[model samples]
Target: MYPERFSNLPEYAFPRLRALLDHHDPGGEVVDMTIGEPKHPFPDWVPTVIADHSEEFGRYPPNDGTPALRGAIRDWVARRFGTTLEADSQIAAVNGTREALYNVGMALFPERKAGQVPLVLIPNPFYQVYMLAALSVAAEPMFVPATRATGYLPDYASLPPEVLNRVTAAYVCSPSNPQGAVASAAYWEELFTLAERHDFRILSDECYSEIYRDTPPPGALEIAARMGADPERVVLFESLSKRSNVPGLRSGFVAAGPRSMARIRQLRAYTGAPIPLPLQRVSERLWAEEDHVIANRALYAEKFAMADDLLGAVPGYASPEGGFFLWLPVPDGESAALRLWQEAGVRVLPGAYLSQTVAGENPGKEYIRVAMVAPKDKTARGLTSLRDCLYR
Candidate 1:
């Protein structure tokens, strides 16, 4: 039977966007900036690598991941975050970060906590999967507002004692989706402290960890290592999607405390979908190399510069520090989205669609998330159109 908790879940972003704008013909040429699908060119050698290892695909892949892939991830974690993890002991491979993220709730959240219904704290305007994961685990999904006042990150510390007491897990996105806010090392420390105080697990989604403007954003694992925090209290999820422009590869990894990793591996042994062997080979190569990531970051940096130069003059423009989205404040997100489609022919996701109504107010109601994941010229054109039609 379907669960009642998810009965009222809002429709996903894209279908709702289609329902909102598909019927209306664009007044000008259409420029879609709604989804964060990467449009960059992946490494040329990727095809060759995959083809060379294609024969391995005939065999079933290991749920715990291969030594080479895990070791590569270990090295990547060390080089990027200055944190070390044992390849076989602390890490496990998954088909993608999305799957791992969902499964974590399944594997960790207990049926009851302190004789009370469990709670899952998630940031509003968050990745939709967080809410789904909570629902699947029968945990009360607590939507914490992540607004500009709070630096665009959720303030779980401000939660009431009762709410905090029941929290089983909390999902945090760095280089956050829609808003593109990067959580700092200080932020991670505070979160880790909160988890320690309340005795809950922290799921850090660092899928966009490699995409940044200035200095690289500090990661949760790095912060944990620095503080010598309880390793079991935190798990970091990462992917090669944005970092390597290999979303179709469907490969990612999770690094957790040894105990947590053991549980996750046990649960995955029965119900997990592992990455294919051939793609695992590709992932090993991707994680071992950073040249492509550097080039990808350069392209995004250029787009960010172009966006700043073009939209900086507009009122209420906040430049994103990391990730590839611009969360632009407009008069009304739904109206602005429709107006943009019908008048400017620019397609961007209405921020309202990404958030839930809390305390009779939707925090994302007045913003639109514009993805900077297009070619340079088209991105500029879309930004210019967005400016001329909506902000002008």
Candidate 2:
């Protein structure tokens, strides 16, 4: 009656959050920190850019991407990462990185590896799409803990050689979603080496790459180029969602080697919804403009400072290098979240929702993920409420 592969999948985090809290009345004004939706303003000119190209909406959009949009992405990559990409051969525009992230597993993961079902390595507390992507393709989604023990990045290289030999793809998120941990250059090198040794590909998710504190995090593409690694070894997915606060715009791209791009484009041609012409036009203008992104990053930087000032004294508080989440430790994630909602009306996500229980241990069991996407005053209020309610 149904695809059994997805039967055991836990409820998506947002629905699970509603089920956990919807019945209870908030004790105070509700300050939702559960979702990572950005409350900041996108560039003012984006609408104008879209309006100017609105006529193109009548035409079926280019499936892979418009040349102008691809060129804009290619140029931006060159400027931002110091790696030149062939717009036509190495890039394919996706509605958002989420879709690309999912489809990529389908397009790239082999039917079998080493005469066994392929393995898709995923960070334990990951973007939910990564797991679904693996499962949809019948690859065994292997969860490796990306906990404090491993510096908040998955230690893929630590896996046994037998397991590594079966890996067809490994997903790595820089400035990770829940943890906000950035992969170091050395970390990238080590992972890249492992991929090479094991003959697996790297699906590098850098959607949150633009939102960070201090130095810009090193990108996998640049690191791969530096190491003289196979171009096909690394495929990067980034979006304007977090970078420009345009999640609704659904604009992003997947960049990889020519051969990989061919497979991705082929899969996308059959089933992908191309970015609308007007939106692609807007994306082109947005990619060329950095003033907006810089301003957006500055706003996140302020929040990072606020988080550190408030929570740094807590025993396990470690300020994230990038991204908009505060992965704060508590005695128990679900209990702390319920307490925050019931006592303080601050809605935050239970970290356990984002991770799986493997062999009776869930890495996220002891923490809650708080999003800093709200405006400063509201974010401060939420953090103060949660801190006083739980950490105090």
- Alpha-carbon TM-score of each model against the true structure: 0.98, 0.99
Q: Give a tens-digit lDDT track for model 2, residues 104-146.
A: 9889998899999999999989999999999998999999999
For TM-score, the strongest prediction is: 2
TM-score between model 1 and native = 0.98
lDDT by residue for model 1 over 225-342, one digit each (tens)? 9999999999999999899888888889999999999999999999998888989888899999989999999999999999999899888788998999999999899999999999
Q: How many residue pairs of model 1 clash at the backbone?
A: 0
Model 2 is weakest, by summed lDDT over 10 consecutive residues, at 383-392
- Over the full model, what C-alpha lDDT does candidate 2 score relative to the true structure? 0.93
Candidate number achieving the greatest lDDT relative to the actual structure: 2
Candidate 2: residue 177 lDDT (0-100): 86
lDDT value for candidate 1?
A: 0.92
> Which pairs of residues clash in candidate 1, taking residues 3 or more apart in a chain or in different chains?
none
lDDT of 2 at 347: 97
